[model samples]
Target: MILKYSNFEKSAFLTEKKFFLFYGPNFGKIESCITILKSKLNSLDRTLKFLNLFQDDFLRHSFTEIVNQNDQDDIFGNKTSLIFSLSDLRVSSEIIKLITSQDLNIQNIIFKTGPIQKGLKIRKFFEDSPDCLIVPCYEDSLLEKKEVIMRVFENENIEISLDHKNLLASLLSSERLNLLNELNKLIIYIKTTKKNISNALSILIDNNSHDLNNLVYLLASKKRNDFWNEFLKLQQTFSDEIKFINIFSKHLEKILFVKDKILLGLTPLNAMKSLRPPIFFKEEETFLSQIDLWNFQNLRKAIKELHLCQMSILNNEKSSKSRFLTLITKILDL
Candidate 1:
């Protein structure tokens, strides 16, 4: 059986089947679902034992050993809730065989994997199995995100205006963990201060705009020392490296557009004027100066470097802060 993320509930895990598969790009949601399942299982069977094992551990240990581990009887009985975070799904055949055998009496077996392709044998095995369920976790839509934010705020007895809620939703990342982290920060802020839209915006948005704008200005104008200073300050204020990369990419793209116009025989001043969204009057002079300082080649190189930095951040989150700082230093040199 297959389940959509929204439709998943703890009751689903109570079926006669012991095996469950949760797979998708949204690891946060998958983990939350697993928590709910575990909580529900524990409530129903207090004596049930919980075991967590990685795929490598499972593969390294003999099948008999795994079965024996699961089959171990406590003072009460031999019931174990097993969770396997699969590092690789290519061994799905062996996993499926082990889970299907009636000889081993495991209470519940949960398998989790990162995004699986549609044609993968492992995905098909779980989806097609009558005795197991596959739950797909996808990114939440904007409306869903808004609902989550509203629910969180409401639970805390904090009332947010629709516009403020929308703004918060726009600022939040689609990933649940990041979103929750931001929400927790905002909730704490609200609890400590005046809980109005103005206060919320002041707490969340006001501090970020100046630093971000200054960082963009410094990078575009090729002020190495100032850019590094602004970058450090912005990093302190905003911990989301991906969001910074996104803002940097947009600014670089704008510069690229202006550079293209300048290449087509337009003066930097005229090119800034020609910008579609129209540069702010106050920033137009600085924008034009940036256009004159950066050429198409440099702008393109910066964009590519920023993109690679973004990919690195996503792939290896642990070193993202250092990676981003290094990227800025490299771009400054470029």
Candidate 2:
């Protein structure tokens, strides 16, 4: 069975099925769904055990070992609920076979994955299976984003004006998790300081804005020392490496766009002017310097490196600061 985000709540309790596949690009929504499912399972049977197994761990260990471990019943003799965070869907055949085995001891198997392309065998298997459900999560629309912002603020008892709400919606990235984090930051600031939205924006939003832009500028201009300095400052200001990577990625995309324009016979100056959000007058010279330093090829390569750096950060959160800095240094060298 396939479910839409809106209908998930109505069907969330259909736990009779043994396999559930939550696959899509909207990681935030996927996580939210997982939380709801876990809550439901706990409510249904408090004694039910929960097992978290990543795809890598599953592949590294013998399949028999996983089955045996999960097969062990709780003190109440109830089977454990296995939550599989799948990085690759190619191993779906093995997973499907295990779940379908008549003697399997798992209460439920929840499989979470990134976007799965069409015609993939695993996707097809889930779609065709009577025992599995497939839920696809795409990016939220503008109305959905607004509703989230309003609901989050309302829950926090932080009353925001409609205009401010719209402004925040615009300022926030499309990624729901990032938007939620920013909203949490806003709520905390409001509760702690009793500050208005304007003050919150100044302190929370504008204060560190220049640091990321400056850091990207430094990287584009190949200012190794300055890049390191700004990177350190931004790290100190913002703790989330993923957020930093998102900002860096957006700036790289802008640079790529400008590079493309230049390639299409437009002067660098003309390309810069054509940017949607016009470059700040003060930063124009720096932007031009970066344009001179990086061509289209170099920008593409840098974007790829940034993506790898983001994955490294996500995979290893503890050492992300150092890992991200190293990647920035490498990009500067390139």
* lDDT (tens digit, per residue) of candidate 1 on 1-334: 7877777774554455677899876777898888878777887788887888886785578544675677666667747878888877766777767766778666777888888878888788888888888898865556778988999988988878888888877666567776787788888877787566567777567566666777777877779988777665544234456667887788878888877887899887887788788888988888777765766787888888888888986775545556788877777777
How high is the CA lDDT of each candidate model?
0.76, 0.76
| 132-154 per-residue lDDT for model 2 (tens digits) | 88888865555677899999988
Whole-structure CA lDDT of model 2 = 0.76
TM-score of each model, in listed order: 0.67, 0.63
- List where candidate 2 sits over 4 angstroms from the true fold: 202-334
Ten-residue segment with the worst summed lDDT in candidate 2?
Answer: 232-241
